[model samples]
Target chain A: MLRSPDLVGKSQDSLREAFGKSLILLAEDYPSLVVLDADVAGGTGVHHFRKNFPDRFIQCGIAEQNMISVAAGMAETGLIPIVTTFAVFLLRAYEQVRLSVAYSQMNVKLVGSHCGLDVGPDGGSAQCLEDIAAFRAIPNMSVIVPASPIEINQATRFIIEHKGPIYMRSGRSPLEECLDNSYKFEFGKGKYLSRGSDLTIISCGVCTGRSIQVVKDLKELDINVELINMSTIKPIDQKIIIESAKRTSKVVTVEDHSIIGGLGSAVAEVLSEYHPTPLKRIGVKDTFGESGEPDELACKYGIDQVSIKNTIINWLKNETKG
Target chain B: MTKSVKSNVNYIRSLIVSSIYHAGSGHPGGCLSCVDIVDYLYRYHMSYSFLDCDNVSRDRFIMSKGHCVPTIYAVFCDMEYISLSELKTLRKINSRLQGHSHRVAFPQVEVSTGSLAQGFSFAIGESLGLKLQGYSNNVYAMIGDGELQEGQIWEGAMFAAHHNLGNLCTIVDYNKMQSDDLNENIIKLEPLQNKWESFGWNVFNIDGHNPNQIREVFSAAMSKENQKPSVVIAHTIKGKGVSYMESIPSWHGSVKLTEEDCRKALKDLECTDNEIEVLMSA
Candidate 1:
């Protein structure tokens, strides 16, 4: 006797469609292209590439380590390889990525599905909240966190053309469509959803949508905040971050990963080295998550909009006190 | 080839004994084993220059078995890739000739290969990239018999075969011993030729220490017209030159070169003080 889950939301299906659309666009564009997935193809949204080009698609069947090494070899042999699996599975192949791909500077794209506590219900083992932080630690790696389905497709296209090792973190659930076919996408540029001088909210991936809402909620209290979508985590738009820090002088970094080494740390590293602005970090505080709903986990880990806004308000108050 | 064989063997043997004696530590067993193979490859089979080591279009040789680098340093010194005087500085601090071939220190070397199962992939990548860029150069990767156990080596093998990478040739020093133990006891890799042939590779088996067999097998591998990747499994001894150390695993990484041992090896090489003076001067 299993409980039937709610299907009332319009979000989850959009993520699936967005991921599929991106793969289709990639296959249409690159001739020397191939996709490799472990057993979880449907979960990773690589079914579109499998459907369109069965011959080019490789189902490596539960061997993530072997899949990554083979992908590196394929990339060596001039095939653009896109490998997809759960975030934990990607970590299983991290050593392969480090030596075989990154050390050799091979062009292979790794797509990590079900990233963060957003995975929900499958528990701490399945969800990979530490993925972005772990991936950004690797040198010469480009980390992309797509906010919505539209960005997932765009990120895929951009990664295909960018010519380096790419890690695209795709969420299990979806959000409001952030981009359209008419919308332009750039690799290393952070998009500004809102502009203000009082405080800057720099975030990426699913956290970007929440950070936008946090700014909106704060505006009702007369706190104007700038919102930045720092999607490319490595080779990050450091100039934009530095400029935002200098202009606002108050910054709040938010993400769905560990506060120790994720987006918060990346931003802090940039500011600590350069501007040294007043900053508040919002993310999981050095702890593993448990089985729960996505929103419930967000609340439990203080990842919701109210907590983000509260952190910003407290930072401002603390700076005034000093 | 026949005229240079006795001299090359004696020179490589003396180099192995002296270099290890000077270094005080090195994998002498494997290096002594692979000298004739490397000698035949560089002297007669492969095309390159000793004068200008920076030739862009020359064939590339990668030492996948980096622990057995006494052979490479010896051959390169014999061919003047570096000075024989520099050879005296093997395994010393700040020496160009380290325990492994580093591309940063040596320009002519292709990939820095201390890590196993990776050199083959780099060689394949370089070969494919060179071919794609319209360069008429060949890539040769020399992998040790025991190192074939690495999974990435198989991946490289599959990629090269599937892509029909004719420009790539891999040679295995199948000495049947690795690291003071028999390879079978560690990881059994038998019927080696069949294993490679099934992997869609054109396989050749040859007595690795025999100069004529080494050259003939390399030529046969190159003659495959369909341009498929080829593997030449060279059957070799662990330590071929020194009678006391030959085929013995204990001598793999241990240094046993006393002054008496050096004198004995030098006497076996049949060199005069004039040749030693010439070696020292140039």
Candidate 2:
């Protein structure tokens, strides 16, 4: 029952930092907890965990594949090993994660930091736009993308308590705080920040904050839109998504990832199979991202609040005319 | 080798041949090659009972070369983890004994390992965990010479050495042959002993088929004098014990065993008619 801080208009905090902090807190209770990093402790912000719990922290040097398998082995021996590295680099160990962690059903926590175009100057190679899809395809893997710093902390605690393998996504830059102080995190459940009747905006990770801003800005034009944070991308909250789609016959799915097999594709699968609805997926189309500022990349990739606002406005106008 | 150890080795070889023959497909060559080492580990080396397979203090064994799991399954049967009758259902639908080591199907297995090189890493993690937990038990991982081609094996080697995991012991069934061709033709794993030594392991090269040599090497590996991880590079013939299959790459995987083939293999192991009858019936 951790209380979230008042996150409205406050200075943002890094989700990666919160991940390290949460590990410190979790280690206090679970002695079996261990942290492993692949030469990215400073980059992923697990340096705090390393500093605080030196004995509990394992620094695997520049080997993502071995790090994952080592974590799997640790989990096999009844220890909870949290493995952190750059999201893009995690793809190098995709087979290891699949066979060693997921197929074995080991209780290893995989935290992929600096995900998507938000990695900014690190460019297309560093940015991990396909991690969610890669991990989501693996059986027994729970894919979670925390919307804000507070949600990241909550998700961290929730994953440590919940058993089995998990893949959690975090960003490099500080993200806008969105959850209220009383917000309680739930696994595989979506939270509606604002509700309206015109249409529903579904987003996760950093994009959820931008979607909330888009909803607020559209309110000036009397364009009432609902904002839902679909955090758990794998075991996605389909009940809330279907209900939201039924209420507002249109949907817009946004994420700071590739539109092919990410949040957009996941929602599309749900809607097409269970409830057919007119949907517009607002995220990176089939294209590779370039090096730029975080905000600049978001805008260029059409995932920022302004892009989302314009896309919805145009979609609404067309839908009404049709 | 003691009389009982010799009997155990022969029984395991018989089981491996029979299991693969019944399944109509499996890596019989590597399984036969690695059976002697597996037998030594289970029958003499490892410290655990069948009734208490989940004992925390028990030594951990990981078969990294997962295709050769019939040898491990034979060891498991000897340990009474599963019935001899169940070994007949090796790759059958819904059988607990999967084609490879599956943790869910067989909880006694340290980790599920089929996709090569990954299991070695798991062994490293387990060794690290054991050390952190203040456990005195050693962790043993077995890999194929061909599996050394996978990059993760080197990565695990580096990590184990870096961590100074003295409690970890890795065995490589250095059979000259791989699936399609000789290891030298496909990937030269020669200077393999030097590779492990440079990675900071107490490397031991031994005749894998000789149970006495395997026992001596394992004992040396377990000695408290060594401060680094140990890897026993056991030189063995692929498809050992079976004359027709020995040193043959075609026996590496999915060898369709005819009645004559089965008889020839069992006869090579010197199985009696009654023993062959029981094996075939199962």
For model 2, residues A136-210, the per-residue Cα lDDT tens digits are 999999999998877887898888888999999988888668788777678999988899998899999989888
lDDT of 2 at A265: 94
* Model 2 spans > 4 angstroms off: A1-10, B1-6
Tens digit per residue, CA lDDT, model 2, B1-282: 112334677778888898888998888999999988887888788886667777778898899999988898888877677777898999999898889888877777667877998989999999999889988889999999889999989999999999989999999998889999999999898899889989999999999988689889999998976679999999998989899989989999867787778878988888887778788884
Best by DockQ: 2
lDDT of 1 by residue, A128-195 (tens): 97888888889878888877665666777788887889888887875776544464557888888889
TM-scores for all predictions: 0.78, 0.96
- What is the DockQ score, from 0 to 1, of model 1? 0.17
In order, what DockQ does each candidate have? 0.17, 0.82
Candidate 1: tens digits of C-alpha lDDT, residues B4-90: 344677787677667777887888888877888787778777777756665656777878788777788888777766666788788
lDDT of 1: 0.76
Q: What is the lDDT of every predicted structure here? A: 0.76, 0.87
